[model samples]
Target: MRNKYAIVIICIVALVIIEKENNIILRVSDKLSQFRTLQMPETSSFVIIDDNSSYPDDIYSENVLGAREKGQKHILLMATTRSGSSFVGEFFNQQGADMFYLFEPLWHVEAMLSLGTNGTNSSTSPWVYRDVLKHLFLCDFSLLERFINPPPKDHVTPDLFRRESSVALCENQVCTPVIKGIFEKYHCRTRRCGPLNLTLASEVCQKKRNRVIKTVRVTQLDTLRSLLEDPQLDVRLIQLVRDPRATLASRIVAFPSKYQDWKSWAVNENVSVKEEEVKRLEGNCNNIRMSAELGLSLPKWLEKRYMLVRYEDIARDPMQKAAEMYNFTGIPFTPQTRDWILENTHSHSSGIFSTQKNSSEHVEKWRFKIPFKLAQFVQEICGPTMKLFGYRFVDNEQSLVNKSFSLLEEKKFHFS
Candidate 1:
C-alpha cells in the first residue's frame, strides 16, 4: 500500500512537470484549470511549486521574449513546516497579479542533485541538481493558480498568464532570466568533482537576477553555519518563527525523537490522568531545552536579522499578521496586494494538522485529550516555561504546598 501510494504521488508529480513545461502562456490565475490533484484540507502546512504545477494551457498569451517586470516584485517566505510557514508563503504568492511560487525548497531537496559524501560517482547524480533548479527558475506559474483556488468542481482557470514570466530571448540558454538563462545548462554532462563549488552556485543565483530566496533554518544562523562562514558567501536571511506551543503541537511526531533517552520520552496510556503529568511535563521541558540550545547556538547577528511571528496571531487573523510580517521584512504591502490576501488567504492551521486554507487551533488540545497524568506531568515539567508565556496551570505546585500547610494548621488546632 505504501509503495502504491508513493507511486501515485510520483506519477502525479510527473504529470504536473510535463504539463507546465509544454503548456502555453497564462494570464488570470482564476481562469486556469487543474489536471491531477492532491487531496488537501482548506488549511495544511502545504505549498504548491508552480513549476511542478499542472493546468489547462493558454488563457493569457503574452510572449516571454520581451517580458519585463516593469518593476516586477519578488518576496520569499521562509519557515519550517507546522509553523504557519506555508500559510505565510501562500500569502506572498497571492500578491499583485500572478507571481512565482517556489514551494518548500529544502523539501526532499536531497532527491535533487546529491553531492555524494565526497562528490563522486553516484546514482541520480548531477542531473538531479540541474532539474531541480530548472523547475525553480522555469516552473509554470499559471498551473499554480488552480492550486490557490482550484475550481470547486474542476473548471479551467486563467492559465495564459504563466507564459508571461520569461523574457523574449534565451539569455545564453541557461544564465539570464532562467527561462533562457544558460549557467548550468550542461548540468546533464557529468563533470568530475571540485567544480560544483558553493561560490559558483551563489554566483549563478546572483546572475539570474533573483531578488530574494526563501528558506528557513536561518541557513546563516544555526544549521548551515559552515556554509555561511566561507568568506565568499553573501547570504541574507528571512528568519520566521511561531508560538512555541503551536510549533510543538504541530510537530508532535518529531518531538519524541529529540529526547536523549527513549525512557525520558516514553508514556504509558494505562496510567491515571494524574500519573501522566510527569511524562508530558518531561517532554515539554525537553522541547523547551532544545529550542534554548538552538537559540544559544544562534549567532548574535541572527536576532537582529529575524522577524518573530506568533503563529497564533497568523492563524486567528492572517491579513493583519501578514502585513506585520511584510512590514518587518521591509517588503512593501499595498492595498491591492492586501486586498488580494483578504480575498485568497485560505489556510487556518499552523498547528499539527496544518491544513491549507487556514491555521489550526489544536495547538494545545492535548491538555484535554491527553491523559490527566500526562497533563499533570507536562504542567510540572513545563510550569516555569509556561508561566513565562503567561499560561496558568490547572494543577500547580503552590496549590499542593498550600494543601500541605492547611493539614498542618488543622493538626495544630486539634493539639491546642
Candidate 2:
C-alpha cells in the first residue's frame, strides 16, 4: 500500500510540472511572434537593439521606448504654410490610435479676431493671440471660448471645421461637447452637432494621452518659450523647414495666378518691390529667424526638448527620419507606423496644398519648375537662411515649362 501511494504522488507531481512547462512555452512563442511582426529589418538604422544583444529587453521594451510615459505630453509642430506641417502632424495621428490632435484650432480665432466680427475688437495683438494659444495648448478651452464664442464667419465653409480634432472626437465623451459649442454658438448651423456637455472639454483635454497642437501662425520660437517653462506640461517643439527655392516654387505652383499677377506688377512698375513683396519677404525671413532663435537663444534645458527637422531630409528618407523623430518625442515608432509612412509616401508628387503624394519626388522640385532668374531672386532673398539650412543652389536651369503648364492645368482641374 505504501509503494502504491508513493507512485500516485509521483505521477501527480509530474503532471503539474508538465503543465507549467507548457504554459512557459506558450508565453515564449507569443513573445517571439510579437517581435516577428515588428519585423524591423536587421539593418534598420533606428532599431534600438544592439546587434550583440541576445534579448529585445536588453535595450528597451516597446512600452518604455516611445511616448507612453506615465504623464501627458504636449507636442507642438511649428512650421510655415506649405512647409509640410500637415504631413508631420499626421505622424502623431497614427491609424487606430487614440490621440488628441488639434489641426489649426487657432484658425477660427484668428479669423474672427482679424475680421473684428462677432463683437471682437482690433486690440487682439499677436501677443494676445499667443497667450490664447498657450492656454489652449494647456487644454484650457475657457480662454479659447472667448475668442471664438460667436464662431468665425468662415468656420463652416471650406471645411475648416472638418480638419479639426474635435470633429474626429465627437463620438468620444471628452470631445463631443467642445465641438458642439462651435456649432451651438452659430445656432447649430451644420449637421455635425451632437448632444454633450461642453464643460467637460477641459477635463478630457488634461487627461488625454497625447495632446498634439500644430500651428503655422507662429514666426518666433521665443513666443512659445513660456510653454517650455510650464511645470505641469511636458512640451516638445519640432521646427520644420524646407529649401527656400523649393518653397518658392511650390508657392508659384499653388498660386500661379497670384505670382503671375505679382510678376506683371513688378515688370510694369519697373519696381523690385511690390505691395505684397515685403510681406512675403518678411514672412520667409521670420521663419529663418525663428530657426536661428530656437538654436541660439533657447536655454540648454529647453534646447534638449527641441528638434529641428528639414523637409528635404524627411523627404529623402522618411522612415529613418520619422523613427528619429519618434525617438526624440518619446513616441513609439511601431511597425504600424512604418506601414503608414510607406503607404502615404509611395505616390506621384502633387503641388496642391490639400493633397499628398510621392514624398521622394518632392525633393528638389524647385529645380525643374522654378525659372532660373526667379530662383536666383529667391536665393538672394533667403540667402543666409538657405546656407544655414545647408541647401545648395543649383545654378543649372532645367525649366519644365511644358510640365509646369500640364501641372497647372491639373491643379486647376482638381482645385477649381
Candidate 3:
C-alpha cells in the first residue's frame, strides 16, 4: 500500500512541473505579441476577421487607398532645360503659404562643380545629385551650403541662384530686415531683403506641410530609385516632356550663345546627322526614352508614384492639369493657387525665365520659329521618343506651319 502511494505522489509532482512550464511559455508569447503590435506604424490599423463572409467585396479593387489624406508629402518636379518646366513648376509654387518651393537648387551644384577640373561630367553624376537632393528634402541646408559659390558666410548667402523664385525664401521672417527708408515697392523682395538666412530657411521648411524641388539637372530617372524607396519620405515624381523640335527651337532662342551652331545650321540649311550637336540631341532623346520605359514598367518601388505630363497637355488646359497634379501629391487646391494660375496663364508677359504667358499660344509658337530642315532632322533622330510621347510628325514646311494641323495626338498619361 505504501509503494502504491509513492507512485501516485511522483505522478502528482510531474503534473505540477508540466503546468508551470506551460504557464511560463504562455507569458513569453503574450509579451512577443505586444512587441509586434508596438512595431507597427501608427498611421495604419489592423483588424482580424473570423468568418469568410467578413471580407470586403472590393478587396481586389484598384486605387482603393485614393489620395493620401494625412502625412507629409515630398514632390520632385523633374524635366529637361527649355521643356516648359518652369511654367509647370508654378503650379506647385503658387500653393499659398503651406508650400516651401526650391527652384533649381542643383544650379548651384552644376555652377560650382564646373569650375573644377572634372567639369560638368563630375557635377552631373546621378549619385552626387541624389545625395544633395536627399539632404534638401529632409530640410537640411548644410549639404547645399557646400556648393554655394561665395561659400555661405555663417549660413548666409546673397547669391543663392534665383532666390526670388521661391516665395517662402523671400518672406519677412526668412530674409534680413530691410534698411530704414528703403522703398520696398520699388525693389523686389529678393533685392530688398539682405542675404538669405539659411538657418531661418531650414526652420521655415520644417514648419511647412509640403516641400517641392524643381530641377532640370537630374538627367536620368532610374538614378532616383533609392530616394523613391526611402522609408522616411513619401516622394512623388512628376516628369514633364516637350517635343524635341519645339525644345530645340526654344533652346536656340533662350540660349543663343550656347546654340550658335544650331542657329547657324538652321540659317545655312546644312544640317547633318553626324554633327556633334545632332549626336548630343540623340543622346538626350535616348535618355528620355529609357527613363520613360522604366517608369512605365511600374516597378515595385514606383507604383502610384511616377507621373508623366506633357508640356503641351498642361499648356492646353492649365487648370485641369494643375488639379490633377495636386490630387496626385495629396495637396489641396486652394483659392490662392487658382487665382495665380488664372492671372499668369492669361497674361502676355514673356521673359526668358518668366512663368507668365499665354500658354496655349506658346505651345505651337516653335512650329513657326524652327526651320523645316531642322524639324525634319529632330524628327529623324528622336522618332522613337516622339512616338512614345504621342508627337505627330510633319511631312513638309506647309504642314508644320498650318495652324489647324495638330501635332499632338489625343493620348492620356496617368499612373494612378
Candidate 4:
C-alpha cells in the first residue's frame, strides 16, 4: 500500500510541473507572433498569451545592444499649426525600432473623448487626432504610409480600430525594439491590470533608439496628467512653438490666394494699417482670439512626463535635438539610431512639405515678401506668443500693410 500511494503522489507532482511549464511558454510565445484569435482562460486574470502564428519571425527576437544599455527615453512631440512639428517628427522617425512616429494619438483619443461615452466633452476635429495615434501604435502600419504623405489617410475612421500586440505584452505585427526603454501613451481599453517584469524589459531588443509621438492636440495639461497615470505607459512631452511673426508670415505668403483675391482690389484680411478694414478686422479679432485660445488652453500645471521643445532648435539641427530628446526620455541612442537620424532627418525631402509642393515652401520665402506694416501688425497681435519662441517684433516702419482683394473692395477704389 505504501508503494502504490507514493506512485500516485509522484504522478500528481509531475502533472503540476508540466502545467506550470506550459503556462510560462504560453506567455513568452505571445510576444513572438501575431494572434488573430485570443481567448483568456477563466482562471487567468492577466493578458492571455495568444499567437495565431505557430511559427514566429526573426523580427520578434531581434534585440538592440543599446536598448539593453538603458540610457534613453521615449519622445512625445506636440505643437500648433504653422509650427515645425512635422520637421521634428521627421527628425525622430530615423530611430529605427527604438522610436515610433505616433503622428497623432489625439486623433484617436479625441474621437472617443468626443463620443463623451463617459462624459468627456471632446469635439471631432481634435479628438480624432489623439485616437489615431492609439490606433496606429496598436497595429503595424508601415503599409498605410504608402498611400499618403505625412499621413496616408486624411481621417481616422472606426474601421481602423483593432486589437494587436505590444511585443512584451503579447506578440503581433506591432513588435518593435526601440521601445524597450520608454513607453509613449498608447491607450487600449482591453489592457488589464498586472505587474510588469522590468528585469525582462531591460534587455536591449532593438538596434534603434526610442519612439516619437507627434500628437500636437495634447496641449491641455489636465489631459496629459490623466494619460500618464498608466505605469506601463511612459509619456514625455516635447512642447513645440513657432514665432508668430514667422508663422503668420508663412501662412499669408504660402496661402496668399486663400486669404486674398489678387484678381480684384487687394485687401489684407488681417486689417490694413491705412484701410478702413484694419479697424474692422482689428475690432473683430474673433478668429485671431479663437486661434490664440489654443495656446492659452495649455494648462498652467506642470508634470515630469513632458519636456518643452522649440521649433528653431529642430530646424537648425534635428539630429542634435533628437539626441537630446532621446537622452531626456532615457532611451539609449545607439550608433544605428544615430545613423537612422543622419539618413532620414532631411526636411521637405518628402510629402506636402516636399520640394514638389511650392505652396508650403512659400512659408520660408515670405520673409522678404511681406509688406512692412502688415508684418508689424501680425507681430503686434501675435507678438507675445511669437517672442516666446524667438521671433523679433518689428517697428511700424512703412504702413504698407499688404491688403487682400476683399479689403481693397471695402475701400471702394474705382477702376482705371
Report the number of the highest-lDDT candidate. Answer: 3
Ranking by TM-score: 3, 2, 4, 1
lDDT of 4: 0.42
Candidate 3 local distance difference test against the native: 0.78
Q: Per-residue lDDT tens digits of candidate 1, residues 267-353?
A: 544434334444644554455444433443455534423343445456566778778766644456767667756654453533443
TM-score of 1: 0.40
Clashes of 1: 69
lDDT per residue for candidate 3 within 1-416, as digits (tens), equals: 99999999999999999998676545434433433343211212321111111213232122222213436788999999999998888888889888999999998767655544234455234655675686677677876776675567888777788878888888877878655653332133444786777889988987788889999988789888877876567889998899999999999999998898888877775643347777889999998888888887778889989999899999999999999999998889999999999999998887877899999988889999999988998999999999999999999999999989899999987586
TM-score of each: 0.40, 0.66, 0.80, 0.47
Indicate which candidate wins on TM-score.
Answer: 3
Task: Provide the overall lDDT of each model, using Cα atoms, as 2-decimal numbers.
Answer: 0.37, 0.57, 0.78, 0.42
- Angstrom error of the Cα, residue 333, model 4: value is 2.5
